[model samples]
Structure formats: structure tokens, C-alpha cells
Target chain A: MSTGRKYLLQNVAPYGGERTTVLLADGVIAAIGTDVTDDDATIIDGRGLVLLPGLVDLHTHLREPGREDAETIRTGTRAAALGGFTAVHAMANTTPTQDTAGVVEQVWSLGREAGWADVHPIGAVTVGLEGERLAELGAMAESKAQVRVFSDDGKCVHDPVLMRRALEYVKAFDGVVAQHAQEPRLTEGAQMHEGIVSAELGLAGWPAVAEEAIIARDVLLAEHVGSRLHVCHLSTAGSVEIIRWAKSRGIDVTAEVTPHHLILTDELARGYDPTFKVNPPLRTQRDVEAVRAGLADGTIDIVATDHAPHTREDKDCEWAAAAFGMTGLETALSVVQETMVDTGRLTWADVARVLSETPARIGRVSDHGRPIAVGEPANLVLVDPAARRVINPDEQATKSGNSPFRGRDLSGCVVATFLRGRATVMGGASCDEDVVARA
Target chain B: MKHLLSTGSLSHKQAVRILDTAGQMAATQAREIKKLPTLRGRTVVNLFFEDSTRTRISFETAAKRLSADVINFSAKGSSVSKGESLKDTALTLQAMGADAVVIRHHASGAPHTLAHSGWTNGAVINAGDGTHQHPTQALLDAYTLRRHLTGGGDPSGRDLAGLRVAIVGDVLHSRVARSNVQLLHTLGADVTLVAPPTLLPVGVEAWPAEVSYHLDEVIDTKPDAIMMLRVQRERMSSSGGGFFPSPLEYTRGYGLDARRLAAMPDHAIVLHPGPMNRGLEISADAADSPRAVIVEQVANGVAVRMAVLYLLLSGNESNETKVDA
Candidate 1:
């Protein structure tokens, strides 16, 4: 058995008691107490720093295999670690996607080799993400990959029977189906969030009810099957009510709100910049506040970075021609800190709960979302909560530089991240060279 | 001259300048020999990706009036339907020694793409893009509105100040509505958008126009012009059921029928970017009524487009020469 190097973080705030020293050995926290005398141990000062459990993301599009130029397992995982995330549920909307055990296992193995962050490969609920028929859910679940989440994320599973069957089938294996929640028929040629701006701009409007209707139906289907369902990036105020009603009825449903969805609104679409374009598009400020309130009150359970990356060719044209997605992994934590924490809607503890703890619990990742203590897995982050900086997409570590938050000033920054006693990021920068060398 | 894509960006002064120039063009149309030598050396291409008879011919007429050689490129009989890409067609047009390409594509921003894509160095005019701004349509509508409401007193030189306009119906699918809203606002008209909530695009609060669920509320404000948008049935298939519930329900709630037409102020005119759903958006009686100005809007379209072409192409000659020098 290899004994991991011991390091102590003294005076970690808001979680472990003041002046507590956390000791790590063999990937787990070995001790936490007032004093521990070890002459050979390396002690690091941690005063005025908040020790947070490693973040987990339920939605991240790691464009791999075919579209590696946009994002790869190596670059995207490094981005995740830099954003304070220790594990991310890699979406199955890749080229030759995670629709089968073979593909899922390949992505899983690539993530293991990358070794920057834990990549939990999400299997596609339908073959080719076509929304026509179910993929080999059981095979993916039982394979060496062990994908417990099934999703047709980029495309909506619009067929009711197919949705119901997927909902019912996933119950057998205790797997939760995460839905992208858009009615394709209603949103055909839909460019932006359907509202006054769409009317004014004369772009095709994508109605909120298109998304709300899907969530309403899926939540009811999950309730009927007595299964768990995770709603991905709930955007509208109407969606909040549906999810609130679902949770009130104890339907075993959890919802996630994206960092972009919580902060950005449809007003940005007026400029016709493709960077603002996204799926379940940015809605009104009323919807933004509702989503924030949802996050605060637990109506929304997680802050998933729907970190979709698109090539510049896909996004640099007219508003209608641009692909729907924006790079979110690197900016997710800062946005949450700005929109939720600095605004008094949530504290650092709430930020930790939403960004890290709740998402890990929802995805059923056991080693993740552990408390920062002895005997716990040393997956953690150090945050500089008072740090203020402007977002520069060119400076982001993600392969794609399509962040709409580019050039906007944001509060708070992630200083370092430790994944299983490994410092994957330090001093607000990704330790990519070391990880690549290790890999 | 580049094609007028969407009126959403035209200022009052710019709109007036275009309309005044169109008035000058209209004077030429009235002459026995209706042609000009200004664009005799230029070639104009009418690239219609969607079905259109009135818009295409108006553009063709406008080009001929300017004495430009006109090439009609309809998508139905062309290689576009066979998937011979837009770039290929542009190259083909370029090979034919085409000077300016006037393209009306079903895809929004298609003309903008063609112009900026270096597909052709010739001036590109947007006939229309998918539910996006139609600059010429808004200009002509403004011209017609100015002529009817202002009684031909050179309303071209002035913005629609002290004017209140209510735009009704299918705001979501109507590029005309989008262009009119922006152009009218820029020209100083207080605009209101009246449609079913489903017909309004997603984020409407940020729009300059006030949104109302009913047209009666808009009429209560006694608008200067009540522009009715044609409700394309294809939008129903895309938007799903209950877009208006029924044509009868739409007529009752939002349509500018004879009864609703009577409710408008006598000075207020009815505008439509034609091929009107006669029984749906407006009654046959109301459409032909003296207050309609629907036919006049069409006549104004040719003149306005002529002015846009002449100004954009001719007005930039000095700048082009400077660059060449």
C-alpha cells in the first residue's frame, strides 16, 4: 500500500472547525484534529481560505473523438479541474456518441488515461441520439464503463411512448434519465428564446412552453414509473413551477440550472452575436431570477455546467446560422459566485452544496462530494472568493473559446483543486504539464 | 446598390432619403419611356429561394427601371434545389459577369452571408431572409404610410414623430413586423405589437414596442397606422396547435375586419405586406376600403426599391473610386 504525502490546511473556514489541520494519506484524509506532530509532513498554510468539497458537474459536453478540435478528453478535463470540479458527467452527444458500451468504455478509458478529473460517461438513451429507439442501456450500465445516467441531451426525446419507456426502463437499474426537455416540433427553425425580443428581431421564436411542456410530461412519467429523473438546465420560470410541483409531490426528481441560464438573459440576443446562442436558449430576467430562487430553495438541486463547445466555424456567422452552445466549464464557478453568492442569494456553503455536494449525490458518485475531513477522499478546492477578474475567452483553457461571458467582469475565482490527493490545479491555473507527464 | 435586407436599422433621416429618392424614381416610372442609363452597365440578379410572384417581379421591375440587366434566379428550376450549394451558384453568377445580386432566401441572413462571404464582390441586396428584417418592405411601408397619413407633403424629409402605430398579427413569423418595429421606432413612431402570446417571440420585453394580447387595446390607443401581418399557415405546423385556436377566433380577437377597421381613427390607415390573408387578417371589404392602402403599399415597393438600388450603388461611386485610386 502506498502512503500518500501528508499536508495540513490550518484554519479552513465554514466547514471544519477553526484551526483544524486535515491530514491526507493514500487518497483518503487520514486525520483531522487540533494538533498532529509529524516531523516529516509538509504543512501548507490555509488561513482565510474556504475548503470546499470537489465540484461535480451533471452536464458537460466533452466534444471528443470526431470533434476533438473543439474539445477533447484531455483539454476539457483540464478545464474541469481548473474550474474546481473533480468529476463531471461527460455528455453522450459526441461523434459516435456514448450510445453503446463500447463507446462509453472508450470515453471512460480516455478519461482515466487523461487523469485530470474523473469523467463519468453518460450513455445515450437512444441510439445515435435520434430519439427513435432505446440504446443498450443495460449493457452500458453493466459494462466496465458502468454508466448509471442515460440521456438524449442535445436532442429531445419527444415521442411520449419512447420517453415513458426510457423512464420505466431506467427504473429497473436505478438509473436516472436526464432529459434535454425541448419539443422539436414546436421549436423547428427556432433561433432564440420566444418572446418580445424575438418578435422585435424577427428571428424564429422558440417558445418557453416547448421546454415547459416536455418537463411537465417527463416529470409525470417519472412519477408514474416511481423512478428518478434529472432535468438538465431548466431555463424558464414556468419550468421552475413544474419542478417545484414535482418535488412537492415527492416524485424523486432533481433539477439543474446552468451558470449561463442563471445569469444571462434573452436581452443579449438583440446584438445577434452567436456566442449568446444556446439550447433551451437564454430566457427573460424574470426566468433568471426564478432559476436563482429555484437554486436557493432547493427546487433546483444542482449547478451543472452545460459546458458545450462548438467550433468557431459553427458560431461566427449570422445569429440564425450559428450553432447552439457556449463553452461554460472554466467560467461556471465564477458565474455562480457572482450571480448567486455576491448577490446574497446564496453563501459559499450554498455554492458548495449546489456546485459540488448535491450534484455528486444526485449522480450517485460516492467518492465525490465528500466533506473536507480526515478519512474522506481528498477531492477538494481552494477558492479566492474576493478575487475579481474579467473573462477573456482567449485565455480560457477549454479548446473552444465560445464563452458569451467573454469581456465581462466577474467576482470570485478558483485557486486550486485536489482530485484524490492530487493537485490538478494550483494558484488559479491548471497543472496541465504535470498531468500530461503522468498520463 | 445593396439589397435592403431588414428595415430594423434604418434611421428617420436615412428612410426619408430613400423614400425621396424613390419618389424621384416613381416620376421616372410615370414617363412614357421608363428606363435609366445609370445602371446600364450593371447586372442585377433576382435570386429567389422561396416562392414569390409580387416581390420578385417588383424587384425585377425595379432593376429594369434602373436600366440594369436583370437575371431571374428562382430556386424551383435552379441547381439550388439539387444541392449545388449557394457558393457554387454565386460563382456561376460571377462567371456570368453579374454586377449586383438581389437575393431573396428563405433562410434568414442568407443575403448578409453571401455579401460578407466573398462569394461575389458585387453589391448584394437582401430580398428577404427567414423571419428576419426586410429593409425594403419597411421602407415602402413607411413611404406608403407617409403618403397616406401625411398627404404627400414631403413626409420623406420627416420622421413619424407624434405617430402611434399598432402592428397586429403573426409577429413571430413575420419579418415585416420585425423590420417595421425597428424602422418605425428609429423614425420616432411609438409602436405596439398585438398578437397572441404564442405569436410573440420569446424575449419580447426587451423590444421597443409595447406588447398586448388583444388588438382592441391597441386600437384604444387610436394608432396612426394599423399594419396587419399575413398569418402564414405553415407557421401553424411549426408553432403547434393553439397559435390562434381558429381563424374565426383570430378574426374575432386580433383581425382587422370591417367592424375593427371602423374602430380605427379616420386618419389611421391599414397596411399589409401583401398577398394578404383577405378573410383572415383583413376582410375583403376592409382590404379594398379607401383606408386600406394595401395596393398602394405594393406600388410604393417598386419605387422604394429603385431608390435603394440607385443610392447604394451610385452614391458609393466616389468612395469606390477613392479606394481604387
Candidate 2:
């Protein structure tokens, strides 16, 4: 946020090909197309780059106000910047849970103070994410953070009445309640996805019907109440079919598919590797195909990095005792490129829509996920789609090194990312060179 | 074999070697001076993270007869109950310089973790682990089979080729059933798994065994041996383990009763890896019948475990190698 400084990005491919020049000035896209030059502007040679609006993550776990031993607004946002995200929706599951306006504002202010990525504190739909009682929703919606998304992500709001009431409550302020759809009874001592691998591995099964059943109930509830419902991390194929059917019947529902779900499967659970252990668990190949089809079509709305971070001690133990979730912020785009774009299923334009525009709309963040045009916010990333790198968790920026795709060679790399025209990342490294003065 | 984790991966030659060596150990047990100086200075620690007095005692006796110092670390009243983890316990034992660590855990792959994790330099022996494998139990079962089926032959370096064995009851939760199926298959035996539809695991069809729902059908095909697995009556719940109607119903369907026992081949033996459910999975009449080797299997367990400890700790080589060295 240098007020009047200009930046001239030379010869970059904007979304759908055709080499073009883009210029940023006064925190807005000053110009696009031929002969875009400014004398005083810092010139960046963006040859062999595909420019996209900086990614907007609807699901991010900034373990602040609580588990700073795992992550913080500073480190989490810095990791986000490296992943080409300009804004992220901070999940509500924290130490005290982000249930009150006081905690939400504190988290939001901390994100602003870090000045790396904009953190929108998601208000918890229930106190402590317990799913028993309603949290302070209206106050959070109107607070300084202006929280528009609410969720009890780590735990599912299993009670039909509770889920429906939360959905209806969020409707009052035009907010969407993101539901982590998992039936508690169906997953009591659940260790991993219930299937052939779980049986062979002797790990307890987390059945797919448990997730699908909850989604089936919640979608009907959302329809009956005429409120917005966002399903967080729809992992199974049956879940896709349910969401597809719900959309066909015209229910107000939007769903996200995590990057890991698109590429990984439950078969990886064979070695008892805790790195592959995650909530909603990696599923079968058929489910992977179904979710891919769902995303390829518009059945799935966006790809959100449910970027959960944990301490090494929390994840490097026995499979049954290991904490669930994979560190995802750094690998989201590359995985998407490997699974979707490189497969010729989605275009660069569609990539921006899913990763940027659609997520910004869902989280209701006006400053982010905007198109790169003259006079729009300069929140974007420069990508080299041909560049490939083998993932090494030791080299990633996230605090937790529990990346399931550690040995995987993924396509594409983010070369530079601009957060509101300020270079938060340059040359694949975090640049804290300049930003607006702290409040 | 530095570690005896499972018999599923045991080769035909390896299975024969273990059975032959177990016969030699069993021969020593009958002597008035039933002891050896083979593992004279070695220490064997029986680490039981699960309560299995039957398995621990068998290993303790085996280690003692071989002149190995024995130590029992039961989890019930130990530091394990004081929030001590498996890693800490393994480290403590490794520091004590135990030669062989016989582990029985409630977790399926705990011994596998301990063996492959560089936790210790000594040999690892899996007494039993949760629904995964009981290698020594399978070894003892195989030894019993060789003794009864060999029919006066020396039985050295020979496989149970063409031997048809049927494993009955609760195959879903029985580590004995899993290990026996694998070892019996590798030893050139055709293994059939008979259980109620609910009592079979999701991936049992992929196993190296014929899956059948009718125990009556398997009894009709009875060629050599029928091993009965224990069905935990406590696991007879609705939400979790597996579905079994009632003890009476299971006894009626899958249980080995006197009438079924009488119809077996004259040489065909009835084996139950004891702490048997007596009348539930197997009737008392069948368990006590002359054909039943439940008690003998217990005695053979000590002998088989002695061979496993000897083979695994002494480079898995032949007794000839030891003599030449």
C-alpha cells in the first residue's frame, strides 16, 4: 500500500493468453495492454508469466489468539502471500473460539497489523464450536471486522434444528454459515475413510454416508428456510451427488472441494502415515472422479484451501492418535494446475473465477478477487505454468510440515504476488519491502 | 528374519524351518532337564500393552527354557497408565539392552511401528496385535498341524502342500484368523474363511482365502484342519465392532459342536486358539473331545515361540550354520 507509487509489469499473459502489459498505480490497475509504461514506476520483467487475481481462500486456519505455538496471523498470512492469496477467511475454531465480536476484531486487527494478507475472521456459529448453543452472530456481523461468514468448521453442527437455526440466523444479515458436514454418531471412533484400505490397515472407518447424510439434511434445511449454506470440504462422491441434486432442485447451497481431495485418495492411508490423515479423510478413486467432475462442471462452486496448520508433535504420532488435517495454503494452486488446468478441464479465466472471484463473493470481501483491469485493485499473482517442483515439506512456509504430497512433483509455481499493489512476495520469497503505515 | 511381525509374508521354506525347529524345541520340553544354553546371556522383555496372560506366559516360559532372562512389562499397572506413550516405553526397554522384545498391543500396527522405527537393534516378536496378526500363534498352529499330519515322516523342510484348512467364526476381529490364513496359504494350504456376513471384514474377499458364509458347507468339505476363532461377546454391540445376533444364535450357526466334530476326517483336528469361548464359538464337548488339540496347541505355543526367538535372534539361519560357526 504505497499510496502513489506505480508498477509496470512487462509482457505478462493475462488469464486467457494474448501477451499484454499491465500497470498498477495508487493501489489500482492503472492500465492494461500495449505500451503500458511509467517512468517513475518500478519495472518488473514478467516474461513467461500468467497473471491471475491473487487467490482468496474461504478457509484458512490462522491459529492465533490460541494456538500460536502452531501458527499466527503473521506467519499464516506470510504463507498465504507465498501461495498467491490476498485475502483468507480465518476459521472460527480457536482457543476460546471466535464467537464474539471482541475476538473477531482482535484477529482481524492482528491480520491488518501483519499487513501480509487480509484475514477475515469467521465468526463461530456455535460457542466453542460445540454445536450445542448459538454464538454471537449479529454482533460479529456488525463489528469492526464486518464478519460475513460464520462456521463451526472442525466439528459438524449435527442437530438438524441447530444447523437450520444457524442457517436462518445468518440469513438475517446476508451472511453464509459454512457447515462442516459430518454426523457424529456415524463417526464415533473414526480414524480414516471407511473402505477397503481402512479395513486392511485396521484403522476405524469414517463412512462416506455420514458426510452425505448430513449434507442431504442441511441442504433441505437451507431450502426450507431460504438461506445460504456453504458446505466445507465436500470429500465424498455421494456428497457431490447430494449437492448436485440439491442444486437441481434449486436450494441455495455452495460447496468447496479441497485441493487434496482432487488429487489424493484413501489408499495412501495404507502406510499409517499421519501426514495423509485428515478430517473428512481422503476417499476412493470413484469419489475423486466424481468430485473432479463436480468441479469441472459448476456443481462445485470454488476450490478453498482448508489450510490447517498443526505442531509436529500433534501430527507425527500413531494414526489413531494423530491430529487430522494437511497444511494446504502453499500447494493449492499448483495442485489445481496439476489436476484441472493441465488436464485441459479448466481455463485460466475459470481458475481466477474459482480461486479468486467466487471465493471473494462467498466471503463478501470487496477488496479482493477482483479482475485485473484498469482502475481495479491490484491484488494478483504471476504464475509460471511450465515450472515444476517436487514438494518438500521441509521447504514449505507453513509451520506444520504435514503435506500429503511431499514427494509429488507438481506443475506450476507462483513467481510473484501483489497484495493491493504492494509486493508481499517477489522471486518466490516473501518481500516485506513496503506497505501502508500500521494503524 | 530380524522381526516376527506377521506370517502372511513368510515364505514356504521359512514356514517349514519354523515348524521343524519348533518340533526340536518340543522334543526338549519332554526331557527331565528341560533347558538349554542357546540364549544364555540374552534378555527377552515381554512388553504387553494389552492384557494377554496366555501369550505372555508362553513367551516367558520359552525364554526361560532357553536360559534367556525374562522381564514382563504389563501396561495395566505400569507407567503406560500414567500417560507414558509407546515410544517412551520402547526407548526405556531399548536402553536396558533387551535382546528380544515380544510385544502384544491393542493397536494393530504398534509392533510394526516399533520394529521399523529404529526403536531398538534387537529382534522384535509380535505376540498379537489388534485384528492384524498373531505370528507366533500361527506358527504354533502350523507346528501342531505338521506333527499331526506328517504321519511318521521326519517332517523336516516340508510344506503342508494340498492341505485344506477352514478358519471359522469372527474373522473380522480375529488376528489369529488373519495370520493363520496367510501362513497356511504360503505353506501351500488352501484356506477357506467361514464367517457370518456381518463377521467378515470389507476386504476379506481380496485376502488369500476362500470366503464362505456357511460353516456347514466348509465342514462338509473338511479335509485337514478347522481352526475356531474367539468371538468377544463384549464386541457384540450394534454401533461398533461387528454384528452377531446372540451367543446362542452364533453357537447354532458357526460354533463347532459335538455333532459337527464327529463328522470330521479321522485325522482332521479341531484347533481353537484358547482362552476359548467354550460353548459360544466352540462347545465344551467339542473342545474336550479327543480330536480337539486346544491344550496341545498351548503347549506347542511355547515350543513355536522358542523357535521364533531362536531363529529371529540368531540370523534366521539353520542350526547347521550355528554348528559350523
Q: Which stretches of candidate 1 lie over 4 Å from their true place?
A: A1-23, A31-48, A158-165, A432-439, B1-5, B28-103, B109-126, B152-171, B181-272, B275-299, B310-325
lDDT by residue for model 2 over B1-325, one digit each (tens)? 3778877667777778788888899889999999988899899999998898899999999999999999999875564432236777888999999898999987777777778667687788888877778989998998888878866667777778888899998887888988888888888889998989888877677788898888888888866999999888776875744387677888899999988988788889999998888889998899999888989999999999888888866654554322110
Alpha-carbon deviation at A378 in model 2, angstroms: 1.1
lDDT of 2 at B254: 92
Error of 1 at A391 (Å): 2.4
Across residues B1-325, which tens digit of lDDT does each residue of candidate 1 receive? 3435557545456676777788788888899998888888788888787888899999899888888889998765554332235667787888887777888776676676677667687777777777786778888988887777765655547667768888898887778887888888887888899999878776567778898998887897789899999997665554455476777888888878888888889888998898888788888988999998888889899998888778766656544311110
The prediction achieving the highest DockQ against the true structure is: 2
The DockQ figures for the candidates are 0.33, 0.40
| Model 2 lDDT tens row, A1-439 | 5556678999999995888889988777889987878899989888889999999999999899899988888888888988989899999999878999999999999999888889999999998888899999999999999999999999999888988899998878899989899999889878888877766666777989999999999999999999999999999989999999999999989999999999999988866677888998999999999999999998999999899888877765556667888889999999999999999999999999989999999999998888788989999899989899999988887777888888889999999888778788888888853453241
Please give the range of 10 consecutive residues that has the lowest summed lDDT in model 1 chain B.
B316-325
